[model samples]
Target: MRDYPNDQNLQDLQERYHLFAHMDAAIIDAERDKACPEGPLQDLVVGLKANIASIGANWSAGLRHRIAITAQSDAHLTKRLRDHGARILPGLNMDAAALGGGTDNPDLGRTANPHAPDHSAGGSSGGSAAAVATGLCDVAIGTDTLGSIRIPASYCGVFGLKPTFGLIGRSGIVPLAPSLDTVGILTARAGDVWPVLQALAGPDGGDTDSQPAPAQWANQTATPDAQGLRIGIPQQVSTVECTPETLVALASARTTLEQAGAHVETIDMPEWNPAKLRQKAFLMTEAEGAATFAEALGTAGTLPRTVERLLTYGSTLSAAKLVAGMAEIRAARVQLARSFAQVDVLLMPTTPQRAFQADAPAPANQADFTALANAGGVPALAVPIEVAGQALPASVQLVGPAWSEPRLIRLAMVLESAF
Candidate 1:
């Protein structure tokens, strides 16, 4: 059987793409040695976001200076990928500490968009998304608290899936917002998303949020659940300010799905405003982030400005405000679920627009659409669809209720065909 070191395709991809932060020969070879050729993911090259720890690899999550830290042991996700026959390529660049949406890292260098190097690779997992889209690796492991995985997938023109909050284990990954953190997959080829997910979906001993592992991998590529699948487009999403290009892409994709025999309908979800939803997400993220970085709080100047700024703000938030935000989010989640109760899945634009320039500040509403899934603790699938003749990638998100990964994947297959 073809293996990582022996596969001509893998060798070719490595030569053509400069996507890794630390692609050490020894670390990769060591992982390759542990791969099971007989496993489901034979011959696959997997990129690990720098934050996802890997034994013996440089473990800094894109820090300005090299810290003398290495992942003395493989993270749960890392071990799972290798055990399932993937050659783990660790240390890909990310927004320093996975703090923001754009994949611009100072310590590890900014990741170039595979489709447009001059543009941003919607980030935090920017390196992983670029690596897959550029063919550097077959798939990548990325962590998403907000839209980290999906935004980059939309920007890079690939597929990214953020399963339900507690579905995938988050044991060794560096925390951005522990309460919202979710580890997920990014794939070059849509067909492989399920198989890779099959190998990795499960609870970890250490992840406090870990719930019952999913048993629906078979359904990832299977037909929708027992009932007829219903796809919903929220009314609020329609009113959000978005680029004309995104509006066009959303219309095009929706039309295609409807034509493909799926029941597509618009549902009212007044509580789900993109910007307000983001603010609530920010409040929750900051509060948890401040606690996560409590050790670094004492030596604030040493931290990155963005990290420090967010942490500082998070530290000072009035307890009543945080409490109010949490209550509001909880109500929003319940309200969002009621919207889902009418449909088996929900559809929305993954980002407000296609990839932005590297220098352009991210659209304040960039994660507006995608963060709904993260905030609600539901599953979301971001599929890149070709908007006829457009060179830039346009993508849409498919969201489902918590633990509805199977249904979400089923819907993703439809978008995959339409794209």
Candidate 2:
């Protein structure tokens, strides 16, 4: 088995993504008390977002404890994790405003690209991706409005799942794009993804958006194994900044699956441009986030600097623009839905590139690949295949229509097994 080194390994992991806030030694203590726990996850430490509301140590507490500037522990989520016999470690952070800078929490600050530490880990969910990739935690929970979850997963080279909207509860999580916001998970492998998903998903009475998910153990009747799997790869998505190594990673995976008797098709979605769709997503999310925080900002209370600026900018948005953006988003969603109807699963580059250096400053443009799912309200996953030379990690994104999470996961499971 391949083992990543531990000398600065955690720090190296911490630098790769921006979602983790802090680690809770106490959480580990709590886990040790459990008897006959589940397999690997029985003793796993999971990171969460700072905005999740919990009764014990929270984002504010993390700051004071000097554990993390952005790591927040949701009292509610933490309590639930305990009830389920799981431990809640510290929360992770995105950039100050959950904007472009990367992970939050100044002390735990932005994650360095695990491979480099100079580039970005991706946003909002950067810490979560970083934590999982570096083995800081078995799995981490993140919130996705635009590309918060998927982008960082891509950049950091890991597996991330954004379930269909409303499948997972959002009561205790932070709000970015309210309508678009969904709880997501990041992990090292597909098997790990399902376990965390099982724990965190399903309807919660506390969250209004929570809806009843399918039976946990029952397999969806429609999706079969890789032998009968029909996958779509959008041609347009490949036109992005994908390098030879990245392409090889995906191509090799595709070839292996093909050899295993899975059906692979090159899809053409002339209407799909991940970059353009993401721009609209950004505007819509910022506008909605502005509205969500309007009251808080109206007061003289201070928010993280990035959040403050985001709110201020949102304040400037006109109702007309918001309405127009929604209309456009709706159209895009319809188009994407129609596209998905042509195939059971769609695959694309999780990120156009790989991880950058940990200590490096923010790049000019970020969150490009991860925004499409948010715009379309579809379910997606980012699965890492390789951490090639010079670059740390690279992954492939699998997309499915809304409410198709079960099917998506099954497919991901096959891919996981193949790899």
What digit string (tens of lDDT, one per residue) describes model 2 on residues 1-419? 12222335545444444434654445434433445244434545666666665444445311323234332444444555555555554556665445553563454465655655667777767766777766767777777777677778877777788888887777755566678888888878776666566666566777777776656433444232567767888787665766676787789768766776778899887766666666666777778777766675775544655566766887788878778677767867776777778877777776666654445654433445566677777789887776444456667778888777766766666666655
Which residue segments of model 2 deviate by more than 4 Å? 1-41, 60-77, 104-108, 215-224, 299-301, 357-366, 387-391, 417-419
* Local accuracy of candidate 1 as per-residue lDDT tens digits, 29-82: 676677355688876888899988898998877665444678989898888887
Give me the displacement of residue 105 in model 2, in angstroms: 5.2
Worst 10 residues of 2 by lDDT: 61-70
How does model 1 fare in lDDT? 0.79
TM-scores, each model vs. reference: 0.92, 0.82
The best candidate by TM-score is 1
